[model samples]
Target: MTAAKVLVAYGTKNGSTAGIARTIADALGEQGLRAEARPAAEVLDPSPYDAVVLGGALYAGRWHRDAVRFSRRHRRALSGRPVWLFSSGPLDASANKRDIRPVPGATRASMRLNAREHITFGGCLQEGAKGAVARMIVKRGGGGDYRDAGQIRAWALGIARELTDVTGGP
Candidate 1:
């Protein structure tokens, strides 16, 4: 039997989230699922996929505007399906590996849609890629690329396993 299709939709400002989405999609594909990564704004409908992995970059405890918009616009359809949410913009300077909760916008949508999971990943900070406010924050927070590929791959694999259990994909 063919595996269920999964959509890995993401919203990004400096493109880190997009890269993460693509990496997740690739990892999912390796785990025997059909997964496609696309910008959340480009997806007008959530009807085509059996499962969704929605993610967005977080800034000051807020999700990207497009991701929030997509979640709101597709809330009805999304509620009926298996959906997962992720936040990909936390600076991991400290050793704390506690789960990062979704932003307020995402939390509301996840409640309405009953999203299955919400995972937060570390983000990257470039030299000159941020706005003035963000730049200042980065200067204060210290800058570096904090994304962990192994962690991301493991998360994607777990999601693939969950999808397979739910859909009985081959």
Candidate 2:
């Protein structure tokens, strides 16, 4: 039987979220699943995939506008399928957990999709990669790359398991 198609769509300002999306796609691929990772802005349609994983880099408690907009634009189609949402932000692990609540805008818009899972992962802070405001915040607060690859891989594996089960793959 053909493997189900999974779309791992994301938005990133400094590339961290993109990396996370790629990691997820790679993990899914290892499980004998068909997966593709793309930026939310580049995906004009969500109809091609059986499942979608939407993610974005969070800034000041907000996900990227394009990612949220993509979900909203395809809300009906997404609601009928399995969809997962994730955000990469809060470099500190403690902060990441505390930032669990959805941003107000995302919460309002995401209600239409009925996403199956919502997650937050620690983010990376690269020097010279931040916008003016992000730079100021990083400087004042001190920043570091706090992404835990093990944790990320575990999350991806879990999602792959869930998708494979739903699709009756293997």
Candidate 3:
């Protein structure tokens, strides 16, 4: 039998969220599933995949617009399959230290889509980050990469286990 296809879609401004998505996709792929990470804006359809992991970066305590729009646009298809949601934002180790809840928009999306799970991962902001505030944060020595790769990989592997059980492997 063929492996199940999974899509790890994300919305990011400075590309940190994209990195998280890639990590997730890689972990899922290692578990025998076919997974790919893509920008949320570029994905017009979620129907082609057996499962989807949607994520967005948080700005001003809100989810990225592209991710919100993607969830809205593909609500039907996404709802029909197993779906997971995540938010990346928190330029500190707080996410690694504790469970950070999703922002309002992601919470609503989770409820609407009946998402299997929602997680909040640490964000990253480094030199050359876009926007005045980001640059300022970096200049003041307040910015750094806070994403935990091991945590991300563990989460993705958990999802892979669940999906594999449901789909009878892969």
TM-score of each model, paired residue for residue: 0.92, 0.90, 0.98
> Which numbered prediction scores highest in TM-score against the true structure?
3
Candidate 2, pairs of clashing residues: none
Regions more than 4 Å wrong, model 2: 95-99
What ranking emerges by TM-score with the best candidate at the front?
A: 3, 1, 2
Please provide, for model 3 over 9-120, each residue's C-alpha lDDT reduced to its tens digit, 9 standing for 90 to 100: 9999999999999999999999999999999999988899999999999999999998899888999888679999999989999999999888899998898788999999
Candidate 1 structure quality by residue, lDDT tens digits, 32-54: 88899999999988898989999
Query: lDDT by residue for model 2 over 116-140, one digit each (tens)?
Result: 7777888877677769876876787
Q: lDDT per model, in order?
A: 0.84, 0.81, 0.94
Residue 79 of model 1 has an lDDT of: 69
Worst 10 residues of 3 by lDDT: 71-80
Top model number, lDDT: 3
Estimate candidate 1's alpha-carbon lDDT, on a 0 to 1 scale: 0.84
**CA deviation > 4 Å runs, candidate 1:** 93-96, 138-141
Which of candidates 1 and 2 reaches a greater TM-score?
1
